[model samples]
Target: MNARQPCRERRQRRYREQCKIDFEIRLLKLSILRGHEKMTRATEDIIDSSRE
Candidate 1:
């Protein structure tokens, strides 16, 4: 039981680090998608204004 404690702790720490990395990746993807949407909207607005 004593020897298993350290192993379990290490595994938990590794899992926590992986979760942090995944969260950051998701945030980056979301921001990129938002930026893409904003660019498309801006382009549409320009095209609409030109037609007027």
Candidate 2:
């Protein structure tokens, strides 16, 4: 039973680490998407201004 306790704890720790990594990756992806959206908006504004 004692050996099982350590093994279980190790698994829990690894799961938490993986969750943290996943969260960071998601955040990075969201930031990149937002940057692209901003760039697209800026480009549209430029085109509109040039048409005028």
- How accurate locally is residue 12 in candidate 2, as Cα lDDT from 0 to 100? 100
Candidate 2's TM-score reads 0.66
CA shift at 1, candidate 1, in angstroms? 7.3
Q: Model 1 reaches what TM-score against the true structure?
A: 0.68
How large an RMSD does model 2 have?
Answer: 12.9
lDDT of 2 by residue, 1-52 (tens): 6779999999999999997976676566556767877545665455446434
**What are the TM-scores, per candidate, against the unseen true structure?**
0.68, 0.66
Off by over 4 Å in 2: 38-52
Model 1 RMSD vs true structure = 13.0
Q: How would you encode candidate 1's per-residue C-alpha lDDT over 1-52 as one tens digit per residue?
A: 6989999999999999997976676566556767877545665455446434
Where model 1 places Cα greater than 4 Å from the true spot, the runs are: 38-52
The Cα error of candidate 2 at residue 13, in Å, is: 0.3
